[model samples]
Target: MSTFLLEIGTEELPADFARLALPQLEQLVRRDLTEQRLSHGVVTTTSTPRRIALLVEGLPAAAADLEEERKGPPAGQAFKDGVPTPAAIGFAKRCGIAPEALELRDTPKGPFVFARVLERGRPTAAVLAEHIPQWIGALQGRRFMRWGEGESRFSRPVRWLVALLDATVISVTLQGSDPEVRAGNTSRGHRLLAESVTIPSAGAYAESLAAVGVQVDRAGRAAAIRSAVLEAAAALGARPDLPDDLFDELTDLVEAPLLIEGSVAEQSLGLPPEVLSTVMRAHQRYVPLYRSGAASDPLALDAKDALLPRFLCIGNGLPAASDTVRRGNERVLKARLADAEFFVQADRAVPSIDRRDQLARVTFAEGLGSLLDRVERIEWLTDVLLEQLQLGAATGDHARRAAHLCKHDLVSQMVGEFPELQGIIGGKYLLAEGEPRAVALAVLEHYLPRGAGDDLPSSDAGAVVALAERLELLLSIYAKGERPSGSSDPYALRRAGNGLLQILWERGWSLDLQALLRRATAHWSQLLPHFSVQAPALATELAEFLRQRLVSLLEEQGVDGDLVQAVAGEGVAIERVLSDPADARQRADLLAALRASGELAGVQAVVTRAARLAEKGSLDAARLSPAGVVDAALFEKPSEAAMLQVLEQLQPIAAGEGAARYGELARALAASRDTLAAFFDGDQSVMVMADEPAVRTNRLNLLGVLRNQASVLADFSRIAG
Candidate 1:
């Protein structure tokens, strides 16, 4: 057995992309190796900000040998006069064997020519050399940079490639834009110190890099950065609000991790806390601090806390040696925050509402008109969703008001500077303008769950407004042919579509999705003059997209695929699925049970046949003959009368609700087992067929009705006995 090591050294990749892409790469490698029939190992995978690594231990030096069988045309067709013919010879050649290697075999389609061959195992190194390029090529990201244009696209340049089979560096070359590529025993370390280091084996890679100043473990690097920043803040008697995302991002930007404490200008403290925090984190990747003794003050940080600033940053090395770098970063952060503070104060003086008319200056999307126009379309659609939901008449006015003001903040200085803060700032502005809290939050949360597993709106009004906004974006963008492709979703349409479903599901309302969609899209039809792109008949297509999402959500919840096919087999009511008192697991069990009972199966078959015959409509009990009760003279045996009794007793009980109806009918059938056995033993088919046409039809109808009645509780045909 030998160990395997694969490393992909690349230029700095975006922190967020690295975090997601590396695990995917590891999984892909594991799957590929396993599929290749390489056994005997536990796979280990790891990622640093710059590279993704995989190590497999206990893997055999070569793949195991295996036997394979090949089939050809029938034996009768392949042989002529009891000797091998041209057809047989041709098959042998196709299988890479001589005629003598062929054999005869029996098959479902008479007999056929066959060949048994044993394949020899190849060295693991040979396999790795052949597969690595394809493996890397399969890796993708939201955005990839193509270096030198020779079909090489990665988040960054492929700086170094390390492939070791055991301790040997496998001989492999990558052909791409860079042209020259070779497997190597040496890899680079922290860019600041000992940038180039030799790695002897898979086991030595981590230690080799660490000794030269790089923390190859992303988690450790992150921990080191966080612990240092917090410790520095505690020493100053304050709290360090280290943003987790910013900390993660900074760790990836360097090979060696360093923790530094920096401060903003004292005069800048007058800005809103959120405004200041967003600017620092967004522009400078700094962790904000709160003075336990006093509010975070830039001057105090430069004074008593001078050694400890209002913001703490983790660079890639020691602060003493990087003084110029530290001071320079601080100056840049202060300037960004100063601009933020100025924007906030200026926007307040001209409040976003007063600037609403100015929204025409801002284009939400080129050719799609301005922010003001999108708001108008959204406002109109909001009314349609409200009407479909039959919300209080007051809701229409509120939705319109919320929609009109939702994008108002896009023009505000705070939002203009930081696009991520658009909805948040809008919400704040609404509250300040004396709008209701619900309306304000809707403005903010209508874009709730900007991504998967994110929060959703909690109020009905909020949900309604959210649905309207998302549908508008989806229709408008899809009309422009800007839909997400492969792994890229530039407009975040997938997230928006998902968020719309989540809000409806969480709200547990049975609003008619198709109707809501029709109304919403109809409103868009009128709003096209405001759009430059020909609206791509997207309203209907988008509705189907949402239905597909709902189906997926149901499947994930463990609903029976068949039941999902049956229930949602047609159009699904969003509300019914959300309101199912029995969770998905329970519904799955019920479906399984219904399809597992023998009596249920028999009953379903009979009922289905009867239903087809009486396709006109259901027959009333009055229409059924009282004299039609199994007559001993008309009945073939006691069993026929017994089945009748069971049917009559169950018909009414099965009309009731839930498991009780199912249980009671099952008991009724069980009770009549002996009689039904006698009736079938005597063969009642003769008597029923012997009756007059009307009488026979009535008898069959009675049997049909019995089958139909049993079907209500469960599909007997699906039951397995």
Candidate 2:
């Protein structure tokens, strides 16, 4: 066995692109080695802005030969008169065997001839040498570019390649201009600090890079960055705010990073702390420093007046130029802040109502009309949602106003310059213009939890508007005949769907997006007369789409898949797993837990059987008709009478509300198990399919009510057990 390494060097790549491509490169190499019949242990891949390297430990000295069974013509046909026919002879030749050696085997289609064929595996190096270059070329990027007149594509121009096995160089090119430099032990380090280092062997790759001021291990590099920034901020009596995303980018951006703390120009301190922090994060990709009180708790950005005039910077190279770097960066930020301050002052001079009018001319999407039209739809949808969810009346005025002005700031000069500040800037502007705090907060919260695990709207008004925005966009966009197809979600319907589900889950709102989408289509038809209206059909499709997301949300929380399926049973509008999302999840969790305790089988069986039988009848078509009605005059057996009594007792309890409703129903059903069991199986068993029509119909309807209404909380029909 030998240790292997492959280092791909390129012109300084974007931090995000490098981080994304490294894992891909590693996985590709591992897959290639596996397919080549090479035995190897752990595979490791790591990247810096300029390089992505892979290490495969304990790889085989040579590939292993594999044997496969090849089947041929039926034995009856192959051996007519016990002689090799042309088909039999050709098959044996293809398998590298003589026809006489073919063995007879019984298969589904009768007896067949089979042969053991050995496919010789090439030597490990021999196989890798032929495919490694193609493997490297197979790696993809966010966007590809062909550099310097070559046919090769990469995120950035390839510079050098180092590929080795133990002490020998692997025979593969990284696919670029350099052909003379065979893959070997040489690797470059820290662009302007260390020149180069010769790796002694694949195992020594990390140590060699570290000696030249580069940390190859991502965790070690990130730790060093955190320690440096924290220490620097502590010295200045400030705390550094290190968001994971930015920290990861910084780790990718530098081989030997240095932390630089700089002053924030006292004049700029008067600006909103968010303005300062935004400038640092979005434009500069630096962690922002915060001023903390005696307890070392960083003050909120909302504590505008108390913000300290200091910031942090991460320099990618030579620490000797830290002061120069800090001074240059400070000057750049000062100029940007001055521009921002000017925009803020100019923006505040105009009222939000005036800015709201500007949106009338801004297009939201191709066929979706203008931002002004979209806002009208959202405002209308917000009203409908609030009414549907039965949110308090006071939320209506604030949420409507917030919806009206949510996109107003996008037309502002400041937001135009800083696109990411759209929602945050809108809220700030609204507040400065003296809008109600509820309105301002709603405007800000509408874009809540922008991505996975992001915070949701905290206030009811915010949640209402947020839900309105996401629901309206989903319907309006789909109406334009542009659904998210594959990796290209040009419209982030997935994210919007996630936000919608999140709002429902968080507030336990029973607001149905299916109903909302149908209403939204009506709203859009009125607003954009020329737009094609995809109604009730899209509503069904969109509901199923969102339903899948609901299942995913529950599964993410560790609920079993069958449990989620069971809870979401029947189909589409017939049942909704998200009618009261939190409650639905609650029911799913409780039911799943009870079943896992091995206690629900008896009751679950009764529920499943009733549902299974009821489903075969018109109870679904006439679902509106009240079920479980029976002609007591037809009751002949005591067992049948007892079961009827149990059903009557459950009717009132099933109509109850609160967390205990489903639990109580479950207990009641479990309690009636023996009686129903006897009624179905006893010698005096009531014939559910009796010769008399009315009598048999009544019996089925009795069970129908149990499946259709009693177990409506969570469909037991869908439960796997």
Candidate 3:
């Protein structure tokens, strides 16, 4: 057994790329190793701003030796009158055996000639040489770069590579070049802290790197980052308020993490903290610290203490003094914050609502008019939502106001400077101006759940506004033919689509989806004169996106893909679906259960027919039989009577309980078992098809009852038992 080490080193990769590329490299390596049949042990991979490395420990030196048996033509058919046919001779040759050495085996298709192959193990180095390079080529990124006259491209240039098996080098070539690269008993430490270091063995990969200022394992790097940040904060009499997401990213950007504190200028403090931080992090990746509270007010200390201002800059090595880094970072922060403060003051000079109207002049898309037009669509959509959700006059009016004001922040200087804080800034500004609570809250919440696992809008007004925003974005993008294809969601319509579903499902409103779409189309048609797109195509594409959104939502809920296909077979009415995630779950569960029942599985088709007859036969149950008896005279046989009796018992409960139709059918089947057995045992078709019209009609009527019972549960015809 031996260990393997591989690293792809390049000129300092993008900080963002380091975080994403390392895990991908590790995953690709494991996949290749598994595909090669080289049984091994745990593989640890790491990445820094410059390199991706993988080490497979306790791996087998070669693939396992094995015997494989392949069956051939049947023994009897394989031979021609015992003289042996070409098939038998061919099988013998393929197996590297003589005809006499061939074996006979019984197979489902009678006897067959079998061949046993004893395969030899191949060297692990040979396996790696074939698979590693190919796997590396499969890495994914938003973009890749080709370098140095080599046809091969990656997220960045491939400067150097190390691939070693224990003490031996496993040479592999990729792209258009094969350089003198070797996997060795050596690796470089933090580029600034230490030069290349040698490892005595495979197991020493981690310790060797760490000894020279590198945390080779990602987890180790992340932990060191956290500890250093916390320690730096404590020393400054404050605690770090690192954004969880930003923290995760920083962890990935460094190998030997060194957290150093920096300060913001007192003059820059007037700029909104979010604006200042965004400018600092967006360009510098610096963690912004707030002012610490004094201990005199214990609770205040606890709260403001956490808000203390300090800069946590993860660097390659420890700096000489805090004053140097602090002064340098503060200089950059002051310049950026000054620009933001100017943008804010310039923006505030204009009235918020008047500025909002100017969004119409700002193109949201190439020909989609301005943000003002989108706001108009949202206003209309919000009104539709109010009616659809049946909100009263007060809530409806409040929601409309919220939708109208939601994008006001888009024109704000603060929002422009910190785009991520768009909604938050709007909400804050609205509150500052003493706006209604609903309107302020909606402005803040309208962009909720910006990503998967993000929090949803909590208030009714926010919910309405969020839905309007998403629907408008979807319509505008889809109308412009910028739809998502495969993994390329350039417009992020999928996320918007998924977000719309989350809102609808969480709200659980029974909406007339088709009617609303028709309304949306009509509204857009009137508004199209204000834009430059082909209105009809845009409307159609928008409708299609909504339809797909419904299908994805249902499919995600574990609805049978086929059932989703069938129901969406008609089209998804998001309102109807949202009225009940539970209903979809129940229907899917019932259909799935019915499918498993061999006897009741044909219910879909049977029920479809019964429903057709019920519609035509016009069986009126408006009045009960005063006599409390089903006409036994109408029953043609004991089976018919027994099935009728069970139907009579189950019908009321089925209709009243609203339990799934499948449960009723299951009960009907259970109750009528003896009757069905007797019917099948007897002449089931005795009166089923007869010269006597009366007898035939009665028998069909009995079949109708059985069919109707199952139809309510599921369309048995659709079920394939």
Candidate 4:
């Protein structure tokens, strides 16, 4: 067993880039090792602002030998009457084996000649030396750079390489315009705290680096940071606002973290808590502090008192000089907060109404009209959805108002400088203007769930407006041939689609998606006749797109693939899918449970037998019987009469709303399975396609009637066993 280490030293990397790319680097090394037939165990990666290190343990010195089959020409061509021909001889020579060493093997293409070859695996050190450079080059992230005009792109400039197999160094040339740096045992420590240090062996890598103030282990660094913050906050009788994402980023930003307390300006406290936190955490990478004199949860900041005007930051060096770094950061943050205040004050100089007109100058897309034009589309679409949901005028008024107000902040100064604060800033501005609280909050809630796992809109009006806006965006962009394809979703239409479906699922409103899409297309056609030139063609495309997104969402929720397919099968209305995703899911769950419980075997048999006959037997009669009518007078079997009576009873119940109703319909269908079986299985069984013309037509009409009635609920034929 051997301990392998790879250290890529580079210039300071962004915390996010290092944190995201380090895991991929570790995986790439593991994959390369596995592909070379090298077995390893406990591969782990750690990173700081300056370097990423992959330390693997329990790795064998060499890969195990492999036996492989090398197939050659067919038997007919390889030999002539049991004698080796030139073809066979040449193939055996190429395989580095004598002709007799080859064996006859039977293949799909008839008899073929095969050769058995033993391949001795190379040493692990030799393989790592060859692939180390390739693995490093393969590391990528959202932002990568090629320093010194070289094609060797990385998160930052590569300054040193440390690749070792056991006690010996494995050399590799980065093979680009990069300086000819060779892998060695030498490794550097904290850029500010410690100088260069030499790692004697792979086992001593962590201990030697720790001597120089570099905490190479990510878990150790995070723990140190947390302990420092908690101890510091304890002195002030407050809790540190240390969320996981911020904590990770802070830990990655420094090799030697030292916690320091800084003061938030008194004037900045007058600003909104969002603004305060944004300035402290987002702009300065500092954690906010809260005041707590009582015995509240030490880890929690929420209490009856206001948040204290203080913040804590993790410095990259020893605490002795951290005061200077803290003051510098505080000065920089004060300037940013001052700028935010200025932008907010300037935005208020002009009334929100006046700012809305400026949106006409801001283009939504190249061909699509300005932002104001989109507002009109969203307003119209939102009102239509409200009406579809059967909501009264009061809700419609709130949704429309929210739609109009939502994008107004896009043109505001505060949001222009801080794009992430778009919706929240708009809500704050509306509240300050004395708008209704519902209208104000709806402006914010429409952008709820900005990402996966985020909250859905809390209010019904907000959900409606959110759906309308996303639907309009999808239809308008897809109309312009800008549909998301092959992951090139420039318009983020997929996220828009996701948000729309999420709102529907959360609100549980059964708005007709197919109808809404068609309506949106129509609205675009009238509003932008030139832009929506092919508006009529977009409805079906957009519906299928939304269906795929919904499928992805449902599958991601751990629903059975076959059950999801079954519930979303033929005649599964798109309106029901988008309006009541939960109900559709419930139907799938109910059917899946019944199928697994063996409660629907008889029902399945009846549906399979009847639907199969319904297709071939009832063709001409079904074409004539659009209403699927069967004359009672023509019924010869009592079983047929009894089934028709039961079908009539199940009609209104199956057609009723809710998943419970669908479950009841399934039970009723299962209950009638015996009578349906008797109709087809017994001695008095009537031929659906009888020789008598009237009997054939009447029986075919009867099967068609049953099928047509079942069509209202689901296409049982598409259901999977």
Candidate 5:
């Protein structure tokens, strides 16, 4: 066994591209190694901004030999009465064997000529050399470019290549590179701290690079950075705001981790913590330090109190240069914060209401009118949702006020400078202007759950406005005939739909989505006639789109696929699902609970059996009661009467709403297992399909009623046994 290493060095790559390329390179190497029959152990992939490296340990010196049977033309065509033909000669030549070496083999299709060929494996170094260029070419990332009259494309210009097997330099070349990169033992180190270093072997690559100020192990660099940040924050009695995304980017931004502490201007600390943090983290990639015990909650009303007038920058330079790096970062942050303060002062001079009027100049989308028009639509939808939700008059007033001012920040100087501060700045401005706290918070919370796993609005008013805003986006964009298909949701319509359902589920609000959509669609048809399709057709398309999103959301929440299908699948009526998503969510949960508790087996067995037999009857699924449909007088056995008794007990529970009712219905079905079994197979059992037409019809109706009641929970047949 031997170690193999391949490194692709380039001009400083984007942090995100370096992080993304590591896994791609690892996977490519693993797949190719497996295909080549070169078994290996512990494949490691790591990256710095300057290079991506792959190392494989315990690799076999050569791939295993392979023997395969090659099928050829049919025996009759290959050989004519014991004499070899042209087809036989050609087939053997292609197989690299003489015609006499071919043998006749019986196959399913017919007798065919076959050649058993054994291929000798090549040295592992040769295989790696051949695949090195292909692996580099197969890498994918955003904004890859060509450089210096070369046709090659990479995240950055390819400057050098390193390929080795044990201590031997493996021969490899990157085609089309202007510099004509080839494998060698020499590898470059930190741009500022060291020059090129000679690698002794594949196993010594990390040690060699580290000796020259380059940390080649990505995990080691990340761990050192995180530990240093936390320790530095601890020494200052502060907490570092190192989100995972920022941490990963920081790890890739530097080859050697060095923490440089920078100071924030006390005057700049007066800005909202969100603004300060955004400037430090998003713009400058510095980690903000907050007071130890100060709340880090994004929604905290007093979040500004937690922020400290300091930050930590991950510097790639040596410790001797720490003071210079810190001063540079502090100067940069000071200018950014000063610009933010200016934008805030300029924005707050005019009231939020004036900003609302300014929205008329900003187009929301083509053919959808201006931002002001969108605000008006949102206000109208808010009222509609408030009416449907019936959260009370005070909540209604707050929501309407919030909806009116939601887009006011879009035209604000502050938001113009920091697009992410849209709602945060608008709400802060409103609060400063003496608007009611409820109204201000609602404005802020309306953009809750900007993505999956994010927070949802805690206030009723915020929830209402949020729902209305998402609804308007879906309706208008869908009215323009745009739908999210596959990975092409440029408008993020799927996310909007998911957000709507998530808010409803989180708040436990029960609003009829189907009725709300139809109303919104009809209203859109009137308000924007140029983009209109028939209201009913558009409403249906929107509902199905949301339904698909709901299904995905439920499945992601760990609901069984069959149970999700039971409530929102194609088998379930769309009206039933959109009528109250909360109810459908509850039904799916109840079904999963029953399955987990070991009760679904019994209920499913009885319900599925009845459903299969119920197919023969013409009874309506809506008819839960056997009162008029079944003739108790036609019963031929005691089991039949007993089964009817159980059905009668389940009618009220099956006809009711919510999880409690469904749970009761499942219990009742499980309890009736014996009576159903007796009716199907016991001494008192009677044939469901009797010779007499009336008796058969009556028996089938009894089963049909049971099937209908069970379906109130789910289609049991869809469940796996």
Candidate 6:
């Protein structure tokens, strides 16, 4: 066994590309090795800004030999009375075996001639050489470009390549380049430190790079950066706000980590902490420090008590030039902060209401009216939701006010410069202008949960406005006749649908979503008659979209897929799902709990059996009672009457709504397992397919009623036993 190493050195690559390419490279190497019959152990990949490296340990010098069975023509054609024929000789020659070596083998399609062929293994170096070029060409990333006269595309220009089997250099060459790159045993070091570094062996790659001031191990570099930031923050009595995304980018931005502490301008501290932090983190890639015990919730911390006038940044320059780097970064940050301060000052000169009027100049979408028009629609939807929810007048007023002012900041100078601060700046401006705190917070949180695993609105007013905002986007965009097909959701309609369901599920609100969509679509049809929007069809489309989103959200919350299907699958009516998303979520949860408690199998068995038989009878799925459909007079067995008794007991529970009733329905089904079994089998059981047509219909109706009652909880046929 020997170690193998391959390093592709390039000009500084994009941080995101470098982070994403490591896994791709590792997977490619593993797949190629397996395909070549080369067994390897512990393949690993790492990357820095300048290079991506792969190392494999415990690799064989050559791939294992393969034995294959080659089949030829039928036995009768290959041989004549145990004498070699021309066909048998030709087949043996093709398989590189003598005619005597071929043996008769019996197959399903009659006997055939077979030969056992052993193929020679290729050298590991040769295999690596064959696959190395393909691997480099297979890598993918955004904005890939070709340098100079080269036709090959990469995230950046390829400058050097390194490939070694133990201490021997593997012969490989990369084509399609103005300056063709070839594999060697030497790799470049840090840009600011040592130049070229020689790898004496594959096992010494990391040590060799480290000696030249390059930390080739990405995890090690990340650990060093994290420790430095935490220690610096601890010494200064502060906490570092190092988001995972920022931390990962920092790790990939350097070959050697050097932490530099810089001071924020005292004047910049007067701005909102979010403004300062966003500027440092998003714009400059610096980690902001917050004062200790600033606030219990870091997200809600105020400017005065939270932000410290200091930040820490990671650099790849020489340690002796730390002060120079610090001063340069501080100067750049100061200039950006000054620009932000100017924008804020100008924005404050105009009242938020004036900004609201400016929205008329901005189009939300083609044929969808202006931003102000959308705001009006949102306000109207807010009122509708408030009435449906029966929220108090105070909350309704706050939500309406927030909805009106939500888009005002889109035209503000501050938001124009920092597009991410749209809602944050608007809320601060509103609070400064003496608006109610509830209204301010609602405006800020209306865009909560920007994506998956993000925060949701915590306040009632915020929740209500958020729902209205997302609902309007979904309705208007969908009515425009563009749907999110495949991977293309240009208007983020899917996100809006997901957000709507997420808010409803989180708040435990029971508003009928189907009714809301109908009313909103009708209002849109009236507001923009030229668009030719069909109210009912559009409402139905939006409801189905939300139903899909609800199923996805339920499964994401750890509910089993089958359980999710049982509650909200295609078989379940879309009206029931959109009537109350929270109810569907609870049903899924109840089913999952039943499965975990070992009671679901019994209920599923009984319900599924009845549901299958119920299809033979013309009974409505919504019918829960057997009062008129099931004829007790047609019964000939005691089991039939016992099954009818269980259905009667389940009628009221199945007819009800909410989690408690669903639980009761599940328990009733579980208890009826034995009774249902007796009706289907054993003594006192009536044949469901009796010769008497009336008796058969009556028996099927009894099963159909039971099936209908279970349908109230789920479409049991869709559930997996």
In terms of TM-score, the best-performing candidate is 5
lDDT against the true structure, per candidate, is 0.68, 0.78, 0.67, 0.78, 0.90, 0.90
Ranking by TM-score: 5, 6, 2, 4, 3, 1
Estimate, for each residue in 625-705, the C-alpha lDDT of model 5 and write its tens digit: 999988889888999899899889988999886668887887878888888888888699889989999999999999999
Q: Model 6: runs farther than 4 Å from truth? A: 73-116, 296-302, 528-531, 630-641, 672-678, 681-684, 688-697
Over the full model, what C-alpha lDDT does candidate 1 score relative to the true structure? 0.68
Distance from true position, residue 598, model 2, in Å? 4.4
For candidate 4, write residues 408-433 as lDDT tens digits. 88999988888877777787778778
Model 3 Cα lDDT, one tens digit per residue, 1-721: 7898877776667657766766787787777777667788887777776777888887787888878988888888678787678888988888887887677888777888888888777898898887777767877776788776667777877766767788777776565743434445556777767778877666667787779887878777888888888777777766465777777778767776766677666555555555666776776788766556633211110122333445778865555655676677778767777787787677667766886787876777777778888888899899888887886777777788888888888877777667887887677666656777777778788898798788898888888889888878876665555768899987788888788777766776555555666667666666664555565566556656666776777777666676654444333344434344334445556655555665443334434444454443323423222123345676556676765666676566555544345466565555556554554356652445556766556555555555555434444444332
Q: TM-score of model 6 relative to the true fold?
A: 0.93
Prediction 3 TM-score vs. true: 0.73
lDDT per residue, candidate 1, 599-647, as tens digits?
A: 4444344454444444443455333332444344555455556666766
What is the per-residue lDDT of model 6 for residues 1-721, given as tens digits with 9 covering 90 to 100? 9999999999999999977788899889999999999999999899999998999998998999999999999999999999989999999999888999999989999999999998889999899999999999999899999998979889999989999999999998889865988899999998877789999999999999999999999999999999999999999999999989999999999999999999998878888888888999999999999999867432342466778899999999999999999999999999999998899889999999999999999999999999999999999999999999988999998999999998899999988888998887888899888899899989998988688888999889999999999998998888788899999999888888888888988999998999999989999999888789999999988888888888888888899999898889887888888888889988898889888999999888878988888899888777999999988888899999999999899998988866799989888888889998899888877789899999999988998999888888888888886
Runs with alpha carbons beyond 4 Å of true place in candidate 5: 71-85, 99-114, 295-304
**Model 5, global lDDT:** 0.90
Model 2 earns a TM-score of 0.87
lDDT of 3: 0.67
Off by over 4 Å in 2: 65-121, 173-181, 230-239, 291-308, 389-393, 512-517, 534-542, 569-586, 596-599, 615-628, 656-660, 681-695
